[model samples]
Target: MQTRTHFTTRLAALVVAVAASALGCSAQADQTTDKIKSALVSRLGIDAGDIKGITKTPMAGLYEVNIGTQLLYSDANGDYVFNGDLIDAKNHRNLTQARMDELNKVDFASLPLANAVKVVKGNGSRKMVVFSDPNCPYCHQLESTLKSIDNVTVYTFLYPVLSPDSTAKAKQIWCSTDRAKAWESWMLDRKAPTAAGTCDTAAIDSNLALGQKMNVNGTPTVILADGTRLPGAVSGDRLEKALSSAH
Candidate 1:
């Protein structure tokens, strides 16, 4: 009979052996990464620097590749590549998307709350961060939905990605004496903010860089307390569900 400890040790040995055989050498990780990068560049015509990451998956010989916000898969030697979701048939799970979401998520507390327009409702015990563009129609739609939710503290990052007008509008809103009110007025009441123009608006630039790092290319990207990112303007019911699930 195979004891539990023996089984664990044997499994580890098997994994190591498989990796060694697939990679052809147990060289440094840097070397391995370079080899994979070279293979990807040569075979797939992907720029080596554009490939954000390459890592081994749980399944032997399979590697995960990251290009910007998109995910790809390759064999050990990059001989074959796949650009799609990897589903677990037995567990009925979309592993590829799950991994992508996990990688893209950020610590909610780490966000620069001082830079955001803050709004509190009810007790305001629950917390959420929103990356919004002042010029985005979807952000206006989300603002309408958010008005109905309660007991939450909303931190709105003025992420201006849509147009030059969006950045100008974001700076205008940020420069207002009452940022939250200004944002609400603009997004909900269809009123534009009159720019004070003198307030230091460095936070907007920081938010833009942060959004890029987090792979947030779209407006109205909501981040729940548990680091789950919901892209686009989800419905109020779905938003409630996500909040409850995260809680």
Candidate 2:
């Protein structure tokens, strides 16, 4: 009985030691993260709020710093920081870009579809969303590319950041009776919207805010059904592949 009691006491002590070690490690990690955040904020002149998260990477002593949709790598002490793709030569994978893609993903179901001009192509089986500007040449190019694609529903958010004229054109397009027609007519046919631009176009302002929040610095940003963001003009075939894989 005494031997059993001794063993039980030792086991309890060992468990306690293990738990204390775990707690100590967790506290140390938190401290390290805080130090890194502080160092980055001071060294890079980045807003503390903009530094979303700092996490240890697969590489020893390397940390992944997430700033909005962008990713940067740093040392454990944050003494060194670099912005570039971290490639795994053996696996032929880009870890940094993959993490950025993951971070930039939006919840498709949570989007405000009502704020967009809906255009249905063919049966409109697939879903896509676009942030476009009326004055952006790339947006016009993307509109042309979208014409060759079919069986997709595109929800266009008029994000007029280029100039005041772009905002006016977007307002006109939004106020028109047939928004999709007005947009396509202007984007594809080089014709301007004929609306007096006097309707409740609050959605355009909301879209501008949304775009800013999403870190959308440019027009012609394409979002697939699965919430993968494709910036700039994507080819029709690539878009088709993305659409097919999203399901």
Off by over 4 Å in 1: 1-33
Best by TM-score: 2
Candidate 2 clashes between residue pairs 3 or more apart in a chain or in different chains: none
Candidate 2 lDDT, 1-247, residue by residue in tens:
5698899999999999999999999999999999999998998898999999999888989899999868888998889999988988899999988888898898999889999999999999999999999999999999999889989999999999999999999999999999999999999998999999999999998998999888897889988889899999998889889988885
Per-residue lDDT, model 2, residue 94, is 93
Cα shift from native, residue 146, model 1 (Å): 0.4
Q: Which candidate leads the pack in lDDT?
A: 2
**lDDT score of residue 20 within candidate 2:** 100
All candidates' TM-scores? Answer: 0.84, 0.93
Model 1 TM-score, 2 decimals: 0.84
- 100-170: candidate 1 lDDT, tens digit per residue: 89888779888889989999988987889999999899999999999999998999999998899888899
